[model samples]
Target: MIDLARQQLAHDADPLVVKVGTRCLTLPDGTLDECQVESIAEQLVRIGAGTTRRVVLVSSGAVGAGIGLLKLPERPTDLPSLQAAAAVGQCHLMESYNRAFQEHGLLAAQVLLTADDINDRRRYLNFRNAIRALFEYGAIPIVNENDTVRTAELSRTVGDNDQLAAMVTNALRAPLLVILTDVDGLYDGDPADESSQVIGMVEAIDESTTGFAVVGTHKSGPVLSKGGMLSKLQAASIATHAGESVILANGRSPNILVDLMAGEPLGTLIPGQGGRLAERKRWIGSAAMPIGALTLDAGAVEAVAERGKSLLPIGIKAITGIFDKGDLVSLIDEAGVEIARGLTNYDSSDLGKIMGQPSEAIADILGRAPYSVAVHRNDLALVRDAEGS
Candidate 1:
């Protein structure tokens, strides 16, 4: 088992985010299984009942839950049709949650979110505050993506609910993230490999760890959700960076949540980086999707990744995509490998003109920039990749 002495593990984890994927939440018929929902609900209520502790459930099954009820032949391919399903199913989803929680003397509060709601600072705070208040009032907030209005662009922009759960975990500065999926945890090799073994713990989840997992597309996904093992690791990176523990376990075993609270390591424990990021910094790092790219020279790569320096205009060699001054952008090497991500001080148009130019030349090119730097060190977050898979 992983050590949790620093996290006050002897007692209940104060704040926990439990995420359940669509596969385990439904049966083969693609309908919302009340037994599964109630079992998970009972587990959550038991955790919430612990003194000074609160629980949040990030459920992803609205569209899939609606399919069987609406008698759809299969998952909808078009955006509008999928949104229609989510609209109908979200009601039933909440009703299931409310009824289940009520049985255990708990209230389930529905909180729907979109990308815009999370990216905007004021809106993000409002969402966070609302959920915090719910916990204080002895209510469990059931969160989900507002799929009713999202199009294809939103899928790439907002990512799936797995990433959304990571955002919520950071927004609340929760110490634990439990992502309940069909499998037990990350495996060393293919699940089919008889010799494969589940990796008991991970210090850092990075690109190499992700290389082994299978990603599920809409058609390839089992029933209703877009998230696969790939999305779970992506979410793990975000939560772990914020200095919170993450567990990827089997949702079919509802007792896993209770077991975790009782100090048992029943899943793959992804340890958090020791440096716990501030709330706003965690938000900036995980909330916004990159709108553009900046290819860094070798010197800049070493400086940012090793020396932790600001991205000066001189180190940038290329710029791709169109992004505004304050938009989040990818910082990559010339070979197109991502090194870091941050909010840019210069717009894409301005960056193009200033690439390979000296810092003093910024004033001559764009008349003047918010600052001489392309990306300030304070606004940056390095991407950690595990050594040798």
Candidate 2:
């Protein structure tokens, strides 16, 4: 069945995202391997040149490379030190990429980005346009997290290049995202167990898939970088939910990229959401983090999910957490299941007074004029289920 799906999804014309992990690019001694870099460069050039195919390479290895350059004993713990390492290593890393691409008569463009690029609508569009333009110029983009200055700007977790690549795949609407990693693919259980088998095709990365797969990984302390099987799974979930496929394969294997393009099925193939959500909705449902949550009555739940209506004050049973107007909030049901997420029109305090009231009553309760609805239909998007997929 996985084979049949692979054959059906063999879209050579669809743009591909090739994310090279630190493990693939670093040596056993915790240094950047020139051989691996050269090998990757050759593979990328082979994929991009002599065809109209466009490839986005989300490469990870900056920090590891930095450690070797600075002769550090282990990974740095301080944010400032990590940024310094990123600044130093990013230069040498790109230089290696440039030289390697040149050998195959191709050009490699370095694109440094932060989570803000994806969170901000305008900036995200600009980044998307730049990638498209790179394709027109017949150049492959080497994307990496802007680790140097992102700490202060992004409040969420740090160093998840796997998730970044997934976002890039969604932004480009690429049919496939190949996460080149150290492992062969996702196994049914622990790889060391003989009973565990590599699951072939994943239609949806829901609880079943995630439960069966490992979420965190570390071996012999830190080797090259922080990306593990769990990070890849998170990335796969994001991309697959956004209507994209993901391939997790062993980067150490020769011609892996070529084989995948040929539909050889060398990795675990995770299928995308059956249909594409509007780009704006994908951004809203994903990209931005929810600052707060709103609990809704059964009526409000029906209105939002079944009738495709905006959330109103009368339907909201309670408001939890602090949130301001124009901020994103999760709309949950009485059972505490998240049905949807959306940008709220009123702050939590304001909504608290307006809860269980009619739209016209909002103005009288809040003193100031209020938006007609608590959450406009245009600003709302459905969550997959109670787990908030």
Off by over 4 Å in 1: 1-12, 154-156, 192-195, 206-208, 215-222, 385-389
Residues 175-291 of candidate 2: C-alpha lDDT, one tens digit per residue? 888999887888787776677777767666667676666532336546558777877888887777767788899899998887777668688887776686688877777555676
Compute the lDDT of residue 30 as modeled in candidate 1: 83
**Which 10 consecutive positions of candidate 1 have the poorest summed lDDT?**
214-223
- Per-prediction tally of clashes: 0, 0
The sequence of per-residue lDDT tens digits that candidate 1 reaches over residues 1-389 is: 63565235525346788899998788777889999999999888776664677888999989989886898878888888899999988999899999999998888999999888887778989999999899889889999989997767642357889989988988888888889988778877676666777777877776557765652212333456778888888888877877777888889975877777777667688877777787766776666567788999999999998998999999999898988888788888888887788888988988899989989888888887568899999998775441112
Residue 359 in candidate 2 has what lDDT? 90
Candidate 2 clashing pairs?
none
